[model samples]
Structures are given as structure tokens and as C-alpha cells.
Target: MTTAGTPTFDDRAVVLDGTLVVADLHVGRGTGGSLELPVGSNTELVERFTSLVDRHDPERVVVAGDLLHSFQTVPRPVDDTVAGFERACREAGARLVVVPGNHDTMLDAVWDGPTEAAARIGDTVVCHGHEEPPEQGDRYVIGHDHPTIEIEGQRRPCYLVGADQYRGSEVLMVPSFNALNAGVVVNEMRAGDFQSPLVTDTDELEPIVWDEQGRETLSFPPLGEFRRML
Candidate 1:
């Protein structure tokens, strides 16, 4: 279990003070797989989310953003998928909250629950990271870049943690929760390549990968130093 101020990572989600935070669900994505298997993406999301909730037993579950994929419309299956998320959270006895992202233009159509431009949990601010957050906190947890790192010959999802990176606030950028979304490789990327205004210095950010199989987390050096090693 994590301490009150510390954050724990699991399956693209972070837990801090009895709250589970995830991002970039992109519920309506990958709809081309023969209408028969339309719920494929949804199944993956809900099942994984359920597992996370079960493990953490959080009092609250927060989706940092991109809860839906379509910008202009909300599909029927997409709506159903969202309901699944709600059901899982309800069953787990956790309050679900959403921080809408850029792609979540149709979020209101699906989610009628609590939302914030930037939600605060303790001293940390949770946001979608696509835009500047109105609120302030000592640390910021965001998800929008869907960062990844290539190790050996395989590509793996990663979290970018930067100290004093944004407005003097520590920043933690989680990977996209959706497995279907092949994330951006951040090995050589500079601050300009990132879409998040919160990311000011890529060099100061450290890439962290969670090894589910090994049940361990591997922390690499800051991107500036790690780049030379790569």
C-alpha cells in the first residue's frame, strides 16, 4: 500500500491517498472490427479497470481524460462502454470522476457525473494535460502525450516524471490506458514535440516503465542523460 503522500502505479493508473487515477481511455476507438466484436475495446478497458479497482480498493476513481474518442458524435456502443465503466466503479464502491480531454468533446453526452478542468487530490492536480489547467497544486498528474519508450527491440508504455517541470510543480505524465493506442516514442523528443503545455523541459523528465510480469517498476535516468545512453 502507498503512503498518504506517495503515488503508486499500476496498469497505466496511479493511486494516491485512496484514489485511483487513469487517463486516455478513448472508449470509441478501433470500431472497424466487424460490428459483431464492437465491444472488444470496451471489454479490455472495463476488465482492466475493474482489476485496478479491485487491487487498490480506492475510495475514488478518476479518469484524467479522453474518456471518449469521437469528437463530433457518440456511438451506441461507445455509450454502452461508458456505462460499463460506471457499473464497475459502482460495484467497487468508488466514486468516479472525469477530467475531460481534447478528444472528449462529446464527454457530456455520455458522462453526466462530476468533472473538473483540473481535479485536485491532496497537493497534486490531475488533468488531461492537453491544455493549461486553471487550478494550481504542488504536483501535477497528467495524461495526454501517451508516452512510450523503446527498450532492446521492444516498445513499451512509460510514465514521464519531471521534477519542477511545470510552473515549478512536479509533473507525472501517465501512458494511455487503452492498449490499442500505440503510444509516441519519447526517446529523442524535445519539449516542443509534446502537445501538453505543462511539459516545459523534456530533458528533466525521467522515463519509468512498469513490468507487470516481473511485478516491478524500472526507472531510467532523465531523458537528457538517458538519450546519450540509448
Candidate 2:
């Protein structure tokens, strides 16, 4: 069994106890500007999600936030993608919960399942991190920033973990689950650069990258010190 209050990082998702957590899916993202073209295929998302669910067999799957991309309307492909996620969870017998983010203005049109502004599991509260969470907990899991790190000119998606970050609570931030998002490079970012209120000190947060080839999670020094090395 997984330890309590600790997260198991994999790709863009985190497994906390029996819950599988992902954020910033941003479905229907590629249809906009020339620069916003899709980077990854939708089928790859379902395959990755199913692989995670099958491997972990979690009791619940929580989307931390930003399940959709367009702020105005829900497109047909977006709706289909949402259904694909739901079907995957249902088949695995895991309950799915969506914590709406700032971009999920039209989430209700596509998703009718359970949603929470802040969903709590054990001592951890999961939120989209676009705004202040309604409730408090010992630890907060959020996804608004979609943090990444650049090393040797190669950018990789990463997770940020900090202790006593907000209201004396530890904070865990995940990258965007959607592969299409290149993510915000945090090598030179400070706390003020982030949109999430949960992040107050960028220096205290450590960046963690999952090495898929090595089958290991590499934890780097806190951003405060790591920035100096880079």
C-alpha cells in the first residue's frame, strides 16, 4: 500500500494513496490559433489514462482542474474525449471527480458527474488552484500552473512540491495532463509569476521529473537553489 500524505508521480499524474490525480487536460485545445495546434493525439490520452488506471487500480480518479480548453463553447471532439475519460473510469470501477478550473467554464455542458471546488482525501485537498480554495487541509494538490523545467535545452514536464506553502499547509502542484500543452518553464519564474494563490514561495518548491526510460523519479533541489545551478 502507498504511504499516506505522499504522492507517487508518473508522467503527468500523481497517485495519492488510492486516488489517481491529474490536471489541466484542456480538451479541444488545438482548434484555435496557428501556434496552438495540437501537439499530441487524443487517442494517446485515453491509452495513457487506461494504462495508469490498470497499473494502479485506484479507487477514485480526480481531475484537479481544467478539463476543457475553450472558454466559450464545447466542441464535438471535446465532448467525445470527456466521454472517453468517463468510460475508462467506469470500466475500472473507479469513481471520477472533476474539480473545475478557470478554463472549465463550460464543464457542465459536457460533464454531469460529480464536481467539487476542493475535493478532500485524507489530509490533502485537491483543487484547480486558479482561485483560493474554499476549504483548508494539511496538504493541497493543485494544477493551475502546469510547471515544467528546462535542462540542457530540453524541457520536461515536472511536479512542484513545497512544505508549509499556504496557511501552513504543504502544496503539491502537477503538470498539465494534456500532452499538447508545452507547459510553463519555471527555471526563471518566481512566486509572483504564477496564477495560483497557493504558490507563495517558488524557492521552497522542489521540482520532480519522472524518468520514463529509467523508471525512476528524480527529485531536484528546491527552485531557489536549483536556479543558481542552472
Per candidate, the number of residue pairs that clash is 0, 0
Q: Per-residue lDDT for 37-145 in model 2, tens only?
A: 2545567787888888888899999999999888887767777678888998999999999999999899889999999888788878899998898987888999989
Cα lDDT, model 2, residue 34: 31
lDDT of 2 at 181: 87
Model 1's TM-score against the true structure? 0.94
Error of 1 at 229 (Å): 0.5
lDDT of all the models against the reference? 0.88, 0.88
lDDT of 1 by residue, 1-230 (tens): 21138789888888989889999988877746432225467777888988998888999989999998778877788777789889989998999999999998988899999998887787788999998888888889999999999988789999999988888989999999989889999999999999999999999999999899987788999999999997
What local lDDT does model 1 show for residue 195?
A: 94
Give the residue spans of candidate 2 off by over 4 A. 1-3, 31-40
TM-score per prediction, in order, is: 0.94, 0.94
What's the C-alpha lDDT at position 12 in model 1? 82
